[model samples]
Target: MRTQLSIPVTALAVIALAACGAESGPGSGSGGGTVQPDVPVAGVHWTVDSLTVDGTRTEAPDGAHVEITDKGRARGNYGCNHFGADVSVEGDTVTVRPAEMTEMACGEKVQNFEDALRAALTGRLKAELTDGRLILTTEKGDSIALTSQQPAPLVGTKWVVNGLVLGDTAASLPAGAQDKAYLTFGKDGSVRGSLGCNRFTGTAEISEDSIAFGRLASTRKLCDGPEMDVERKLVKVLEGTATYELNHRSLTLTGPDGEGIAAVAAEIPGEK
Candidate 1:
């Protein structure tokens, strides 16, 4: 289960706060009082939980999340497509400019959810922070609920390959190869997984910024072209030392020539 933030407010402080309410006396303008700190919204991995609009609540898909940086950048996935936008925060208001997103064809359900999320995240929003949750409400009363969470650790995570990265561009896996390749890193300096066609196990030297994979031994198996294509690409990434980045539940391993594979942390069955 996710953890919630706790803040203790004393009775005397509450009483004093009430007493410092607006004054009706002459020339009593807004000036001095205990100013509450703005909510810490940046640099946190926010898992979008749901969107509430017109009294209806819709739960977000498994991988929907948003992360805002202090450098005026906002990047996140809306169910299927990943998006980025320029954002500005003033007091408790967050203004999001129009976002640029990837053009991926999605199923009906995911497309609908993505459209709703895209619409709700635009323009200026009032931010309300309570416990560990952050709610961003649009002027028309629509709201998006999100919860904070730490990034998934590299080791012990089931990373399922979702796309291939060549240089700076990301491309989807070959047809019929989706969800067929996966990798898991072990604490005992071992790595093992399916290569979409064959099963392999090998040693790995993991450091703070890179992973050095040893020669992998795999079972001899024949597969179709699509599967073989995925296996070959993954093999390239698994060879030699590769730098890695973990963004929320997403993982990217890039080889020396900037070729790599992108994966996501998949839930192990019966482990959640």
Candidate 2:
């Protein structure tokens, strides 16, 4: 995700965005009314409910993630690399920071997915951060939304993985399989983690409000450690539950009914 712009627009985003779905942007999202195509400004997050990438229209968890920080501090993940960009916000006028990213190769269509997402975030976007949720939008009614849910406080806490849904189908990690999953939420939304295995990141949108998730990203090292079973079972469990609750030292996950499941993860030191 290294973006050293030769300038802005066209050159940098155009090519990068092309790899993302059928759209090409590296486009811009923070521009004015007269802002040209694929150019953006900084510090403005628009609010649109639905969006279409390339020719596909995705609701629910298939939306966007945007951030316009206070200290030129902006960062987000477009279902891909956690991105860091420069930004400037003035009244209602918004501008984009010179955006850049870290280079971590992933097997999922993450690299391509990011390119398309960045491209669509162009032209005078209007955004709102309400109740801790950040929603930014595009002219075509496209949108990127994010909720600030960080790692929950660890220490004496119990948790569980309920279910895992990839797209629409219910994917089970199986009972005998050593897999595991966890739930993390923010005022904005929720992120069901796949431990160290394949984890999916998605949110529920206006009408397309359904649970969404993705694959896991971790070090490519093969080990037969005990955590390996936790990783495997965690994934299976996530695909079973629809929702969960976390307490000081416990996590309870409700599956298709009130009789769901729960687990107490040994809160890692400093896992807040």
Candidate 3:
């Protein structure tokens, strides 16, 4: 003979409830379901929609955006200034340390936007991505809403130097030297450009966030004192460049010792 043991209906129901609760323990969804994965924030370009500080919300001025790469680097335009910094992400929290930015003067409105943006990014913030939008909320209740978009391409674009890094400082081109310093990257990995006073050609090796110029050949024509000085510094910095970042229409080249160049996109012929 065989004996069958059956559990009571109430006890079985309790057991089922316990198992369900275990599956949706701490950090689970509101309905006691599995926790959703953290939203991906890296390697995406974001355009600012609104930035709220304290309790007041302000629309982002033109040209305000942020791009965070998978390599833990962040670069953006703060309406008036271009900035870059190292970004660290852990779970749903992101921390963007104080960034280095160009000191371009802007109107009062743009300046205020920059000030608020800089303050918002100074420390850690809770990050949430929903409906293709990124929301960064600081512990103090400041929030920035950004819409994700495709970033501008870097290759096959002409760039005009707007500022150059000399030692530890960034300086704009000489007063009369607009559009004189430029760089163009060809489809064949060749770089041709003017170093303010002389035409230069070189082989450039470019990777996902980096660029290195090989032995460069340039015209030997001599120029004025200021132009020559600009050429000398430009050549040195280009030769030493190890990495590059492109944000909107701006390009930043960084060298081994924190030296770099900042350039804006130049309108080139036959290119839309």
Candidate 4:
């Protein structure tokens, strides 16, 4: 049995804010439950939901996908192979496992996924949504944390601002932000953006799973806009989500489907 611990209220708040897309860009959610790990449920579908172990950013398992039906029916492609899983959710408590997998081995990422799937099928979780995205948990605390395989950064090289990654979960926004408004991160401490409405600047730091973005002050006067407001939400929401991607030069971010968010990424200025 994986260790079970009370998740801090602050963390819950942060997770909620991150999933719900609030003014403060925080995360939110709650609850704890006793479970029989592999218990089966009748209606709700429990799916992959996320693929953080492979350093899921906006662009992850670039060629893979996960989809679940409303009745808890699910089917999708994991980057290297096909997979199927069964899930049961007791309010916030979730139990999931991949009932099917391709015989072909896919290295550590796939293997880790196999392990997490097994745990999720039996381990207990505290699940919810904050900042407009869904979060699933197993083992309550971080003891069962999966290692993220973040890609290399082409920073200072001008890759577009794709999206953020929090463990295997991703928060992406293209619908709310301008289709033309864009971004770039440099080797220096500066992070700049076009805002799709106006130019704005902020400081940034690239970490293993999180990107610290803030002091998001903008140009002198605000652009006459709803787009700006939309951009604001997108930026703030992105701050809490960790960042990741497939190709930085491509400036693309992708969100896992059903998570209620889209993946985001940027094209490298000079690259094709």
- Relative to the true structure, candidate 2 reaches a TM of 0.38
Q: What TM-scores do the predictions have? A: 0.69, 0.38, 0.48, 0.33
Most lDDT-accurate candidate? 1
Q: What is the C-alpha RMSD of each candidate to the true structure, in Å?
A: 8.7, 16.3, 15.5, 18.4
Stretches of candidate 2 off by over 4 Å are 4-69, 156-272
Q: Please provide, for model 1 over 1-272, each residue's C-alpha lDDT reduced to its tens digit, 9 standing for 90 to 100.
A: 11111110111112222233333344332554433322344566677789898879999865677776555566676655677665545545666555567765555666687778767766667766566666778889998887776677788989988778877667667668878999999889999999999999999999888999999999989998889999998998898999998877888899999999888878643347
Query: Residue 150 of model 1: what lDDT?
Result: 69
Residue 13 in candidate 4 has what lDDT? 24
* Residue 226, model 1: Cα distance from true site in angstroms: 3.9
Q: Residues 71-161, candidate 3: write the lDDT tens digits.
A: 4456666654666665545545655544467676555666687678667765567766556666777889998787765544566778887
The TM-score of predicted model 4 comes to 0.33
User: Which digits, one per residue and each the tens of the lDDT, describe model 4 over residues 157-212?
Assistant: 44333333333343333344424456667778677876556677888777654466
How does residue 254 of candidate 4 score in lDDT?
Answer: 27
lDDT of 1 at 165: 84
lDDT of 2 by residue, 1-272 (tens): 47721102211221222222233344433331222223222433322233456457544222123443334454543432345654443433244445676453332344455555666655545554455344555566665544433333422232444233333222223343222555454335445444644444444221122233343334454435544555654544445434544433334444353333334343434554
Error of model 2, residue 173, in angstroms:
15
After superposition, the stretches of candidate 1 with alpha carbons farther than 4 Å from their true spots are 1-42, 50-63, 77-83, 88-93, 100-115, 124-126, 139-142, 267-271
